[model samples]
Target: MKRPEDIAEQFQEAWNSHEMTALAALFCADASFVNRFGHYVRGVQEIVALHAPIHETIYSDSTMQNEVISTIALGDDAAVLHCWSRLNIGKAHPAGPHSVDTVILAVLRLLPNGWRIQALENVTLTNPRTGQPVLRT
Candidate 1:
């Protein structure tokens, strides 16, 4: 919360901890998010709702590592950034143990409390020719 660039680390921590409240606290009340699967939702409550179930189900044993790709300051109160995230999924889910790489684009605003994400979109890395998911190098 000290810096906008730190959001990626915070997200990774929250996700790994499986704490939806902690994750929701990182976003603005009216925040918008689009998951790698193309599901879109607006507002922190909706965001929490969208993620909470998954944490207990498909993503129960998932851990994520996020690396900041770039951060651009839009102004004193706003910024945009991309984070490369690698997710290690556990075998508890139906898909079995697997890994996924995604690029997350986030727009953050300097709220009164601290920096909060206003919008975020996650896209899975895929091979263009094969149209299949690709692991990050």
Candidate 2:
């Protein structure tokens, strides 16, 4: 199967399950992840550690869906993918559920075992109303 397709499936399954081990498996040993807020986490072990807390708290009730925008193959052993995802992290804050829209650029390496994310950067798009309506005192 194509790398994008495989990763998408893996993402959906692992994210929906909110399982640390499963999510970490998709990344290469030296992978890195930058969350929407620019929180940088590197290495598979760190990735697992970072996700564990969120999955148990703010992201516990969340669901994620990825939309692949493009995939560029680098010869036969690497590929770059640009994709976006809608994270229903509605319960994370007391403000109520606000689905987050995030864009991700992932570099994948085709290893003997299959494709794994070498690095993934995510940036969240703030809603137009973000920091708007200067609150009353």
Candidate 3:
């Protein structure tokens, strides 16, 4: 099983590469997700469905910068992870639609495949940018 610390970078890498399949694989079948917009959904299928469109739009050219704030074990099969990330919207550059310090709390379980995320909830720590929400290419 991959340790929580080891798999953290994979998530950001998957997002940066825009590989939906790789991104979804990080979660278990019953996994749940809550995006930055505050919308919540259950099941890995739903999580991927919700992300697909967004990744094709605002998050299409985004890259993730993850920082693991903490990790606590829950028994033998699960662990709770708290982290923060900056979704560098569009090509990296000077101030634009900065994704104000997003925070995430995820529950991961030791599944047959690997350590898969079971439930992940995220919140935008601050409001969206005033005029621009994302930089264009």
Best by lDDT: 1
Model 2 scores a TM of: 0.86
Q: Can you give the lDDT of residue 76 in candidate 2? A: 91
My TM-score estimates for the predictions, one after another, are 0.98, 0.86, 0.83
What's the number of clashes in each of the models?
0, 1, 0
* Model 1 stretches with alpha carbons more than 4 Å out: none
In order, candidate lDDTs are 0.96, 0.80, 0.78
Better of 1 and 3 by TM-score: 1
lDDT per residue as tens, model 3, 1-137: 47875556878888888888988889888888888787889887888899888788777777888888899999878899888777777644344555545778888998777788988887766426663333222
- The numbered model that scores best in TM-score is 1
User: Which lDDT value does model 3 have at 62?
Assistant: 77
lDDT for position 110 in model 3 = 88
Per residue, candidate 1 scores C-alpha lDDT tens digits across 1-137 of 98998999999999999999899999999999999999999999999999999999999999999999999999999999899999999987798999999999999999899999999999999999998999987
Least accurate stretch of 10 residues (summed lDDT) in model 1?
A: 87-96
lDDT tens digits by residue: candidate 2, 23-98 = 9889999999887678898899998998888888888888988888889998798899887777776566566786
lDDT of 1: 0.96
Candidate 3: where is the Cα deviation over 4 Å?
Answer: 91-97, 127-137
Cα displacement (angstroms), candidate 1, residue 117, comes to 0.3
Give the runs in model 2 whose Cα sits over 4 Å from its true position: 127-137
